[model samples]
Target: MMPAKYYLFTDGSVNPQSKVGFGAFLLISDLAISLPEAKKLVETVSFENTSSSKLELQTLLWVLAKLDAVATEVIVYTDSQNIIGLPGRRIRFEKNNYISKNGKQIANAQLYQEFYKLTDRIQCSFVKIKGHKRSLDKDGIDRFFTLVDRASRNALRNS
Candidate 1:
């Protein structure tokens, strides 16, 4: 029997007027899910004085927390290089306690710490997806990613 499939596509954008970052993610169990269906699964949040990286991490933590009690795995798709690069930087982050050589905390160190802990406690992986692209594929990966990207950028458009 095949295990249930889990896929999460995420994106984050900062509001220029308020510097409030908005992040959105869509989690689903079916690869054939449509954009309208995926929209129902999308979640959004805003954080004041936040960067895109922090927003990305926060959204990740949000989805991580949404998982059931059994510590199920998830495959995350995102446009953020920061999220795509975490695995390569985990060693340095752990070695230096999430600090830089300048004796200061790395940007979003706290969020990264929490994300690291949660990730270690669960099984997860990351997939890099193109953002704001005008291309579509037969697999629908691009469709879901495009939906998430728009959601993050438009979440607080009126504010």
Candidate 2:
């Protein structure tokens, strides 16, 4: 059976001080026709990390874990091309033990491995969006992304 589909907008940032924060909003509808309509959850996590990419992956893991695999058909909207590219790189990463051709361990290898396992357990996909767009120029859906963008960066500042 096809899983119920959901849309998730996510963003993460890392400050110079190595504080990282991730923001994500989950919606039951494909499009956020109204900011409040069918919006399920807004999640934020903050911690000390040097890599925005790692924080991005961790934020995703946190959200999907909260859903507990019930909402498996999630369309993840994010500005991170690395997250968007994870699936395509999976085969190579797995084949090489998440090591680079130079025999060096890849950055965020553990998180990527966990994500690879999660993809096997459930279903999800990625959609890359432009980041840091001016608020006034955004439409219905993008406004929510702006929300996430702020929330994530706010975490960095507040913590």
Candidate 3:
């Protein structure tokens, strides 16, 4: 039997005018089972006075932290390029002492550090997905993206 593949779709919504944000995630599994038989996980978190980028990165990190050790292979989809770019930028940040071009400490330094630490424990990959649009994939993975997007936005509205 083949191992099950785990897919996580995450999104973050922010209202700059109100300084409110929310992060959401949907987890799906590929198994030879009926739709009802497959477990679906959906969750959201709300925060105030945070940037959308921070919410995005936080959602990704949150999901990673929630993943079980048995989940050997997992893929995470997010609309945030900042979150996707972290792995490549992490090395440079460490070499530069986490300093930015303006000599300020890199933004979200603690979150990025936690994200990196989680990556060391789980064999996972991060993929960038376009937001506020329907997905073109026939496999229906895009549905999860849409789910998280709506959930995050709703959380922002209610928070």
List the candidates' TM-scores in order.
Answer: 0.88, 0.84, 0.83
Residue-by-residue lDDT tens digits, candidate 2, 108-142: 89888888877776578888888867778876667
Candidate 1 lands at a TM-score of: 0.88
lDDT score of residue 140 within candidate 1? 80
CA lDDT of 77 in candidate 2? 86
CA error at residue 127 for candidate 2, angstroms: 0.8
Candidate 3 collision pairs: none
Better of 1 and 2 by lDDT: 1
**How many angstroms is residue 18 displaced in model 3 relative to the true structure, after the best TM-score fit?**
3.1
Is 2 or 3 the stronger prediction by lDDT?
A: 3
Comparing 1 with 2 on TM-score, the higher-scoring candidate is: 1
Off by over 4 Å in 3: 1-5, 31-40, 134-139
Better of 1 and 3 by TM-score: 1
What are the per-residue Cα lDDT tens digits for candidate 3 across 1-159?
334467777898999998788888877665343333332456888767789898888877777776755566678888888978888987898898788899998888888888888888877788888766634543455555777888888877777
Please report how far candidate 2 places residue 101 from its true position, in Å: 1.8
Measured by lDDT, the strongest candidate is 1
TM-score of 3: 0.83
List the lowest-lDDT window of 10 residues for candidate 2: 32-41
lDDT tens readout by residue for model 1, 84-158: 898789899999988799999898887888878787876788898876665744248878888888888788674
